[model samples]
Target: MTQIAQQHANMDETLMLEYGKGNDTAFAELYARHKGPMYRYICRQLGSKQHNKAQELFQEVWVRVIDNRNNYTVEAKFTTWLYRIAHNLLIDEHRKNQVRGEHLTLVSDEQDEGILAFHQGKQEGSVHNDFLQQAIKHCVELLMPQQREAFLLRHEAGFDPSQVCEIVGAKPETVKTRLRYAMSQLRDCLQRKVGATEVGGEREI
Candidate 1:
């Protein structure tokens, strides 16, 4: 990898260790680096229908980071540890919703601009591309909770299956199975939506 790539690979872990040492600037850097993707992850997990609740959980995730700085360790990548906290909180929220007999519902792509932008890519594409993006998001939301988490972590966070296992506290085989199923389901869903000719003809992830 290039020098910048190497730097970025270790930057999160370094910033986190500095934050643990009470370096507020380090904490700021860490937050700025991760805020967008982290927020998007929470919003996707909670679904856009609970935008307000996703915001609360997003804030709570950071607060927990601050409170537990002293307990931070380098056993895994900082993102892994960070998302683990988020995963736990999401589980708790899901449990509460379950007890209330509520299932989170997915909304339109407009519900989360960051995630929409992600699906849209960096530059604008054709109208067909836009429709495909929307269709992809809808299919992602249809996945079972565990499958969704694994898929998002792999695609959004760019983690490998082992890293995803660490983040979601699942075995390697389990994470692989989830990802396989997610991709298979997404492929089938997209094929049905836009026809098989358009499916797997675009991006791989």
Candidate 2:
């Protein structure tokens, strides 16, 4: 394994042990490491409609994580377990809200443009990068829930296909298929939007 992976493995064990012992710092460390990815996952799942709700749900997930720390086991990867909790929480939230299907709207006008500009600068150097970014987000929004979830887990969250399978409760082949379709759709949509601009530039999906 790479050094970062080794370190994360070691840290997971240590932090869990410390959390079991009621060490706040360890729990904090775990939260700090995971909060961004968890939040992003939730945001993507909810799309723009549930920004405040997703934040509230994200906090609730952390609370549950802390409350249930004593029951944590190291059999699976720490992230696998963490994401399982997140997945369950999301399901519960969805059930509570009776949320189904995808909604496409610009819910947050807050810094999306700035973030998109920065990301575009790093990826495509075109002047129309913001338009392209918005188009990509819209295209992603157009995906089926499972395809979007699988795509985000694989590409955005940096999970392997196997780990995504574990998190999504799908077979590895199923995860691969979802990812393949997601990418193909994204490529087609983006090509239509940006007119053959290189997708993702340095970041090979």
Q: Pick the candidate with the highest lDDT.
A: 1
Q: How well does candidate 2 match the true structure, expressed as C-alpha RMSD?
A: 6.6
Best by TM-score: 1
How far does residue 146 in candidate 2 sit from its true spot (Å)?
0.5
**lDDT against the true structure, each candidate:** 0.80, 0.74
Per-residue lDDT of candidate 1, residues 78-169 (tens digit):
88788889999999999999999887754444554444345444223456677677778777776778888898898887777888888888
Error of 1 at 110 (Å): 16
User: Clashes in model 2: which pairs?
Assistant: none
| lDDT for model 1 | 0.80
Off by over 4 Å in 2: 95-127, 195-205
In order of listing, the candidates' clash counts read 0, 0
